[model samples]
Target: MINQDHFSRLNQYRSMWVLVFFDLPTETRKDRKAAILFRKNLLDDGFSMFQFSIYLRFCASRENAAVHIKRTKSRLPKQGKVCIMQITDKQFGMIELFHGQKETVPETPSQQLELF
Candidate 1:
């Protein structure tokens, strides 16, 4: 298990990427309700959106991730799946690899990575 202290340190500069996959049936109304409920819960909990389907990354220390999962599990729609990914080095690398031409300044040490 990840300790609270380590978790805190890790989150100082990085965040956790949460990916939620909706598995609703063909029923349009149920799908809409589930999406609304899911978004509401995340918003109520202060989670931002990174993309249309992906939620914004949060400062999810190991401790926070655990707590977040525990707290949100029950509130999440039953017709969906949740995934948590820790983004530290990889995200930086991707930014550099993709945005290097557009960026004028050099990337930070922490921003250099082989994978995102």
Candidate 2:
């Protein structure tokens, strides 16, 4: 028989990864300011820089993911498009990395898994 407590805990381990991708215009003063502000907001909200114009954060659940997405959406610049993706930790682990001479792996989270 399935233990409800064990099952719930195992399910929470799946967790999630929130990826924020954007390409806001940077040619004009206003555009540049908007871009910088967006970056700052992401950092303020706990996202880590994943690459140029890319950021990521770990979300505890679908609701948490929604909150982050809403925050990102509220700050989106007018000149470009931005996308927020939510993926399970298992899927994140499957991502492949390829670069000319650089080695990087998914970050090891410093916080404990959140349960709510």
Candidate 3:
């Protein structure tokens, strides 16, 4: 059993995640440039690319996740589709992945850089 304070503190660490899945057109030169710029923006904003068109980041709370989602929306290109989802860490952990015909290792979310 856990005490009230300990339990409350544990609950403070909400396991929320923000995932950005995008499908942008790259057929034309302008479309390709838009896609590349979108990708770079995500990286610059501390999101780690999970796959070719998927990215994920962990957040301390739902509000923090919302801020990222809003930012993503503001930067979306007018030519493609972008979706954002917030899921619990447990749900994320349940995802199964395979590379080609072999199973692949799970990805650990990237940590933020710290200044000394």
Candidate 4:
């Protein structure tokens, strides 16, 4: 169980972004059902869809993000793949975003930059 104080502290931060990645190996009845359920749950929990695979951005803290991820993972069907990543503006520049892609390049080097 997570401590309520920890959750509160995390929640004190006012802004956050949550990125969720999910993939279904094969389109099957079970997979589809699981996907639908996951989507519904996310909506119910106040996460807005940012992209087909990305989720919401809101004024939430890290602990809240962790709790949300934990609950989501617990509810997910065992057959699919799901990953939740929480990033803040503070960590934003640690990575660079291309036209619509993410590439790993040295933060200080401009020559090796990858562009979309």
Where does model 1 exceed 4 Å of error?
A: 1-26, 89-116
Please, what are the lDDT tens digits per residue for candidate 3 over residues 62-98?
Answer: 7777888899889999898999999876676677889
lDDT on C-alpha atoms for all candidate structures:
0.55, 0.83, 0.83, 0.63
TM-score of each: 0.53, 0.80, 0.80, 0.59
TM-score for candidate 1, please give it. Answer: 0.53
What lDDT tens digits, residue by residue, belong to model 1 across residues 1-116? 99998866665555544444344343688878887887788776655664466554344345555565666677766665665445543353354333545754433322212221
Work out how many backbone clashes candidate 3 has: 0
> Against the correct fold, how does model 4 do in TM-score?
0.59
Which is the better candidate, 1 or 4, if ranked by TM-score? Answer: 4
User: Across residues 1-116, which tens digit of lDDT does each residue of candidate 2 receive?
Assistant: 99999876665556788999998888999999989999999999889998998899987677788888898888887888898898876677778776767766767766845545
The alpha-carbon deviation from the true structure for residue 11 of candidate 1, after best TM-score superposition, in angstroms, is 6.0
What's model 1's overall lDDT? 0.55
CA shift of 40, model 4, Å: 1.0
RMSD of each: 9.5, 3.5, 3.6, 12.3
Model 3 regions lying over 4 Å from their true place: 1-13, 113-116
Candidate 2's TM-score: 0.80
Pitting candidate 1 against candidate 4, the one with the higher lDDT is 4
Residue 4 Cα positional deviation in candidate 3, in Å, after optimal superposition: 10
Report how far residue 10 has shifted in candidate 3, in Å.
6.0
